[model samples]
Every structure is written in structure tokens, then in C-alpha cells.
Target: MTVFAMLGSTQAMYEWAEKNQTVFYTQILSRLMPAPQRDDPDVQVNQVNISHLTNLEAATRIAFALRLGMQAKQELEERREDLL
Candidate 1:
């Protein structure tokens, strides 16, 4: 996420995430791997805003973004009672 580096603190990070839900959603969309045989094999999805990172770094960035996204949702969702 472009917002990853922008996070100044734990509180600020979640606040920024809450404000920019669409940005994270867009990041998730962009990071989705294309068809295996897509013509543009070299097409980089998550590296546009984030530059000068190695391949491993780019992958790590994506992973962190995904983790934060899921964490945000898990924090917001209401728990349900068990049927059993």
C-alpha cells in the first residue's frame, strides 16, 4: 500500500486506513495476479507508487498491505453467535 509508509503511528495508521478504504480496495484489485499467460508478463502492479524496491521487497509490501486490510475488516466486523 502507498499508505504503508505514510503511517506515522498505530492510531494514525488505522485512522488513515479508515479514511482511505477505497485506496486499500484499489490496492487489492491491482495486486491480483493476472492470467498466467497474460501478454504483459513484466507488468508490475504494486510497484507504480512504490519505487526502488527489489522484487522481494515488493512482495513483502503486498503481503503487509493484505495483512493490514484483513486486520481492519476483522476489527470492524461484528461477531456472531455459534449455531451449535
Candidate 2:
């Protein structure tokens, strides 16, 4: 429960942080979730490989946000194992 809460809160924070920003999670997730399309011929591959969100501070914050969610998941899994 606690783990879920932390993950939920962190995820919510990320969403909230992006509410006013042009770059949202969907933009990044789309690139990562379906895997890179470097091999595919459909999408136009850019010569310069760079992410939209190129700010260092923003990048670190995003990393921390994801790390928190992962920690939460680990905590929940541990709890589940204990319950069983």
C-alpha cells in the first residue's frame, strides 16, 4: 500500500510538473515504450539523436521520479512476498 502510494504520488507529481510544459510523458513514453525505430524504415530517423527534454535539471528530476516509482514497486513486491 505504501509503495503504491509513493509510486502514485511520484507519478502524479511528474504529470503535474508537465501540465504547463510542452513536453509531456506521452512524448517520451512513445519513444521508449515501443522501442527505438532506428532499424525501421517507416519513421524518419534524425541524423542528430537528441531527446526533446534536454535540460539537465529536468532530466535528473525525471530520473529521480522514476527511481522513486521503482522503489515503491520493490517495496510492494516485498510486502506481497511476506504476505504469502
Candidate 3:
């Protein structure tokens, strides 16, 4: 049987999607903005320009970047605690 046939109807697929959907909002994405200039010294400035990307693409990239940053921060903190 076809995938749709197994699922019974398109309505069922739609229902499943709606039920499992996790919406991403601009507000949430804004909170994950790139680091401010304060975090990096003027000598080695880096920048993130998301003006060309769509909302979803920008949000996904920010989320991944934040996750990596958080992981690295946690590891450093843990190592510092261990050394103390």
C-alpha cells in the first residue's frame, strides 16, 4: 500500500503535523543574536550578517551556533571547577 493509504488520509497526515509542530518565532530568534562587541576584543572582531537569510534559516543557524557555544562554555566551566 502507498504511504498515504497506510496513513488512511491526507487529513491524518495534516493532523499529525499540527500535533507535532514546534513553532519558531522571531522573538526567540532575537534572543539568540550573535555576541555583542563587548565579548570580543577590537583586535579580532567577527560579525554575523543574517540580513540575506530568511527567518527560518537565520533561526536555525543561530540555534546551532548557540548550542555549540553553550556546550563549549559548559566544558570550560567544568574543567575550571575540576582544577580548583
Candidate 4:
């Protein structure tokens, strides 16, 4: 139960971090691009691209978290088994 709670908390923190990172990236991109009308197809495509990039960035971060979590869990189990 504690492990599950820890996992949930870790994921929640990761989500918050991901959201902040996306906001930072979006701000940077917005500064680089000129403002355009909402009806403009080019502007819409750029917005979609930004969304895709943000998702990709978040996925990369989550993947790293999962890998680290798995590695830590494995090491803990190994140590426990050794102690027993």
C-alpha cells in the first residue's frame, strides 16, 4: 500500500512538472512566432505542432520516471531477498 501511494504521488508530481515544462516551451515558441488570426490555417497547424511537441516531451519524462522507478524497485527487492 505504501509503495502504491508513493507511485501515485510520484506520478502526480511528474504531471505537475510536465505541465510547467509545457508552459515554458509554449511561451518560448509564442515569442518566436508572430500573432495570427485564429482562422488562419498556418496558425492552427503551428498550435497543433506545439501540442504534439509538448506531449512528446512529457512522454519522454514519464518514460524516464518509469525506468528509474523500475530500477529502484528491482534493487530494493534484491536487497530484501539477500537480507532474508
Error of 3 at 19 (Å): 77
Residue range 12-75, candidate 4, lDDT tens digits: 6567658787874677557768878567555533222435567779788678879999999999
* Tens-digit lDDT string for candidate 2 (1-84): 687587777677577657845444556545557765467577775453336546886678678879999999999999999999
What C-alpha lDDT values do all the predictions have?
Answer: 0.71, 0.71, 0.75, 0.74
| Number of backbone collisions per candidate | 0, 0, 0, 0
Clashing residue pairs for model 4: none
Indicate the residue-level lDDT of 10 in model 2: 65
Most accurate candidate by TM-score: 3
Q: Compute the lDDT of residue 44 as modeled in candidate 4.
A: 34
lDDT of 1 by residue, 17-72 (tens): 68888985687445765746656778867536657888898899889999999988
Question: Which of 2 and 3 is ahead in TM-score?
Answer: 3
Model 2 lowest lDDT segment of ten: 45-54
lDDT measured at residue 16 in model 2 versus the true structure, 0 to 100: 65
Each candidate's root-mean-square deviation in Å? Answer: 23.5, 23.1, 15.9, 22.1
Better of 3 and 4 by TM-score: 3
Tens digits of lDDT, candidate 3, 27-72: 4345657856565455775587878999999999889989999999
Give the range where candidate 3 is weakest over 10 consecutive residues by summed lDDT: 21-30
Candidate 3: count of backbone clashes, pairs at least 3 residues apart or interchain: 0
